[model samples]
Target: MHLNDLSSCSSFTRRSFLRSASAVLAVGPILTEAHFARAAALDAAVPEFSMKGIHLDANENPLGPSEAARKAIADIIPNGGRYAPPLYFDLMKLYAEQMGVPVDHVQVYDGSSAPLHFTVLSFTSPTRSFVCANPTYEAGQRAAEIAKAPIHAVSLAKDYSHDVRVMAKADPNAGLIYICNPNNPTGTITSKEDIDWLVANKPASAVILVDEAYIHLSDATSAIDHVKAGKDVVILRTFSKIYGMAGIRCGFAIGRPDLLKKLMDYGNSPMPITGMIAAQASLMDSDLVTARKKLIADTRNDAFAWLRANNYSFIPSQTNCFMIDVKRPGPQIRNLMAQDGVHIGRSWPIWPNYVRVTVGLPSEMQAFKTSFKKAMDTPAAAFNEMPPLRSRRDGVVV
Candidate 1:
């Protein structure tokens, strides 16, 4: 718990968010929607009809929840009147059993995003900076902003994996280091060994936050072993991806009890009964992870093959989403594709020409291919003029 050593960092005697913590906690939709609203100001050219069209923009599980999860949600609807705290404990126990960790180490949340944000705010401050890979997930960076923590964005390694060495040395006063495994957008994995090295070598006061949101979709090893070893590490897991419970919203933050306690300082609320019961039911279904993993991988590989044959340059990915270098302004292309009823993801400023595309069902992907080809074939002059890319100090696309 080196990062938990508060003496090493500046004390926040007068923080703005502390007074309005309740409002921040209550406005869950704002926190949740913040991830996808980057293009709202710039999306005037894209018709509203695009929302009703093929949605490959968000890395959502098109499969929705598993049958068991759906049944569990339906079964619990009647009991929603009561605050079922016991169900949260049940889910914690179940997850602990499955992951071979102590029950106290697992804290339930509506989704992984809460824990991610809490970890950033809890560990970082203006003096204790946040470090992360460039072009990785931006949610934690948002949290860092609220904390007024300086952010150090280190570039990825040549293979698209996180450059843990550079990240470890990014700041001597670093408080949090975030690593999104099978990273979002790129869908590439940072090796467990690299993460372990980072944990062992990072600034003594820096806590390593490993986001395993996409772990089930890839073969990358989990960082739970570090947490089990009592290292200053926190792991975030979400049922959003493989279990297809994105909308249902159940996730866990596993770490030493003390580390989790620090996160509770910001806000603590009752876990959604629907999310908890659905997660429990999902865990009970042993075949769910395996079935969905194979399904997503098969579909992803097929798309890769198509990209190769069509001479499209794209990053090799292991997760359910990947980035393709459309060789043009990504938003321009995204808008072009949306006009044809195929909506893809926005680009990171680090690589403006690349756009992320979620892996949908085979038919949806086929539609994506058709519309993607059409969008690419359309002359650049045909697309509407886009506003200059605006971003925060940390390079988060705004």
Candidate 2:
């Protein structure tokens, strides 16, 4: 059915659903040209990106949700027909208590992407520009485009961390300054001291957006405390990465109650009952974070060792994904790997020759190693048939 059909669903209006759908297209999967090809291939009768491949493109946990979360989802299946607000309350309360914040300071969503987009729409406009690291996640930048908010993309520092001082001075009329800790693509981190400095030094009218999507995989301190201290900051958390709930879709936006209220100006929706229950179960599992962190780190470290042994250059990552300098166009390498039934992640426009690789199961990573070696071995002349790279006005892939 078309998106307009969503209007018939209770509580879903044409405008709200369209806004949400647009947000997904802007920030969700189908990012680069390669990703667009993969998306189209998925809808094709003879898919190019085979369903049976060792898929590690997205930064998703291959282990799936925790057992407790699985049981919680199963138990809540019967109540799927109900719009259970109580479950949302329970999950919110549990999350707030664990984070040591007031329940009112948290707002749950289907995924952090929605709030991420809405926050940009709420705060940014033609007069107030959006500021962010150049090679970081592009969802907010896309949203800023829709808002007609000018974008100021500061380049990453020499160590691949966000250049926070430069970002703070990017635009005096800045609406939002986005910092994705353990940043996407590179998987490197900006220190909390830099984040603190940015918070204190950013334009007076701007609010800082700190995305902690991969925080569980790293040893970084969260910016949630800034929220509790009533700073003009919003911290985004997702169960998609470490919790293995990407497909299930549960995330949170933590900020002062007033700051969160501004996000509601654009759109809001009821939390999915399954996501709520699973999130609560996941949060209550005390050992889940530590256990999964070590599992991912071990797998990632083994892959790094193999890369080192092979003399391949890669960014030392603290998250579940890392970027490797492929020594050729990233899309060409990605397509070659796809032909070999190994779907990997895409590259950013700023770094056309490097591709991101998500850490998967050990067996999957082994498959990745084999395919990567083969792709690398293939002659650069073999990629002559592939289309040349194209860039949008803002330097993002179209």
Candidate 3:
């Protein structure tokens, strides 16, 4: 039967007709012509894609999963058939001993992201607000949105480090303050003294949420010790970065027992047995952590030197990722490199001329260099032009 004739001749019941109409309307245009025009402008701003490219876009460890972690996962495969075991507590105890905090001070979860979300939900209510550095991880901002809490994003300092002073002053009634050490995108660290100053000067009612996702890669000290000292701080540590267990998805939060208990009111689910086993094994493999960290440091240093030699500006980084100032719109540069089989990172709306790149292996870095040069050598007239860059703050690009 012809589809047009079928639609015209079919007689339908009210419910059936409603359902068919709803199905068609569901996929109806949500984006207006103006929206498409804006999107096309954005697409023009981004780089082209290449199939054979190396991906350094996401800050993921190219060398993932230690041998021991893999073995532990294999050993625990049979246990997934059963309900989640009570290994989380045991793992907590091990982490406590290692970190020198009590078991009550630790909350294990699938990943640090859960604890981060829970912390935001638990602390920031409709009246209270969340304060964070601009250009930090967007997860906490998203959580505040879900909780209907206002978010105050203070711009980072000129050096790309968190301006704790400004952030503290911006939101006196902030319920939660988020600090990502070795801050994402820029890969810069805020000093411990600066953090201490923020804590000391912050509103007494506020709680500090320190995300140590990239701490192990940096030389700066952790705020975890402050948590142990009974500060109003909740420190999150993840096995994903240093242990190369991002896939396994295991991380924990360390804070005072009372603060930790508050997070539990949000409820805690049992940790995945396989994930638990992998985390425990990764923790045990101290040698693997040390070896991999050194490798990352050496490789990152080499990449930094190359960037300097090529006169590409970058934020000096202590972490496994850093931002390269491409002297053009980042999305455009990224697309161009993608076409050459090298996918780098997304652009920071705050830093339009910069592209963040993860520290890959030696060969991957070489590919990035080659792809980057090729993209730069190509004329600007060859690709679509993006809108003028906007800052995370009010200032024009320096």
Candidate 4:
């Protein structure tokens, strides 16, 4: 029967029930009425809250927009109608000076992701390749797929750090090497020495793309200095992280002028006027970065302590996020937490048993603790289970 006809019926007729049963049979055993009914029941049981319940999933700063940035955005509201302002060039100059690079070496984009995509598009081809850690940011790999470029994923080190040497050795013909420092999901840093070695040993024609999106939250060194040294390196930095301006979406790329020009040929136009203003103001408001870093560090440490106390296994992270081995499929635990009004982040297909959690305020961490404990208490048979393993190399599940 048609959907409308079924809805119009007050009760199921014998013929309709037979048709439904046949349709269900054709679908599969997994889609049984009982399974769907239980799913619906779980959905109905989930609590709905008005306020964002301890939003720790996305690694966003709970303390949002700095006063300086807010004021800059407010001051630029009237100039929205006008075409791109000269502030773009000024911001470039400021960032270049701060980074100790020439103005020609820096290019601004809507966000670091733009430069990242553009770089992949500009360089990689079917003949060329992209090399990255298995569980690093997947955006570049996705971009490579769009470009039909071959990708080589080197597993992370035993301590959940990027194995730069292994990545450098993966594909000598690689057009790009993408590294997310204080990597997403795991929030671990690849040592500067290892990265420097990669850059030094990489094929002369390849360009290394270093993503510093979370550098402000960690103690790790940045690769920006390598860019200034005229290496074939593109350092991507974003105001989205510590600046609390993810919504504003302002980020930049720093590299040798020649390499940056290649990326610019494929880059998008200037950023929005308001975003430019907010980014400049944020860069100038250094205090906000320091304060936010302290907040994240304190809360993250507390959460880590709790996890340790409870004998939970996790990658010790220096950034504002980290991955935990939930000892069961991550999606199952994620679903259970969502029912408790806590939506955690996703699990990678490669690391099905681990879930990445972002650091939020203390209260949010407390909520995470409670929800995670409850999730762990769930019956093993309730979720797709994995054997408890001590660790995986580079945090990649073997």
lDDT of 2 by residue, 1-398 (tens): 23344333323122333333233223222123234334423321124444587777778788889999999999989989997655756677688889998777887888788788878887898999999997988778877888899999999999999999999889999999999998987889999999999999999999999999999999988988799999999999999889999888899999887787677655566678889999999999999999999999999999999999999999999999999999776777877777778888877778878888999999999999999999999887787765553433333342
Candidate 3 lDDT at 317 equals: 90
Candidate 2 ranges beyond 4 A from true positions: 1-50, 385-398
Give per-residue lDDT, candidate 3, residue 232.
94
Write down the RMSD of candidate 3 (Cα, Å).
Answer: 13.3
Each candidate structure's TM-score, on Cα atoms with residue i matched to residue i, is 0.89, 0.88, 0.83, 0.82
Q: Would you list the C-alpha lDDT of every candidate in the order shown?
A: 0.81, 0.81, 0.74, 0.73
**What tens-digit string does per-residue lDDT give for candidate 1 at 33-62?**
225533532452553443477888778889
Off by over 4 Å in 1: 1-30, 37-44, 47-51, 384-396
Error of 2 at 277 (Å): 0.3
Local error of candidate 2 at 67, Å?
Answer: 0.3
Ten consecutive residues with minimal summed lDDT in candidate 2? 24-33
Candidate numbers, best lDDT first, in rank order: 1, 2, 3, 4
> How high is the lDDT of residue 65 in model 2?
93
Per-residue error (Å), model 2, residue 374: 0.7
Q: Cα lDDT of model 1 overall?
A: 0.81
> How much does candidate 1 score in TM-score?
0.89
For model 4, what is the alpha-carbon lDDT of residue 229?
Answer: 79
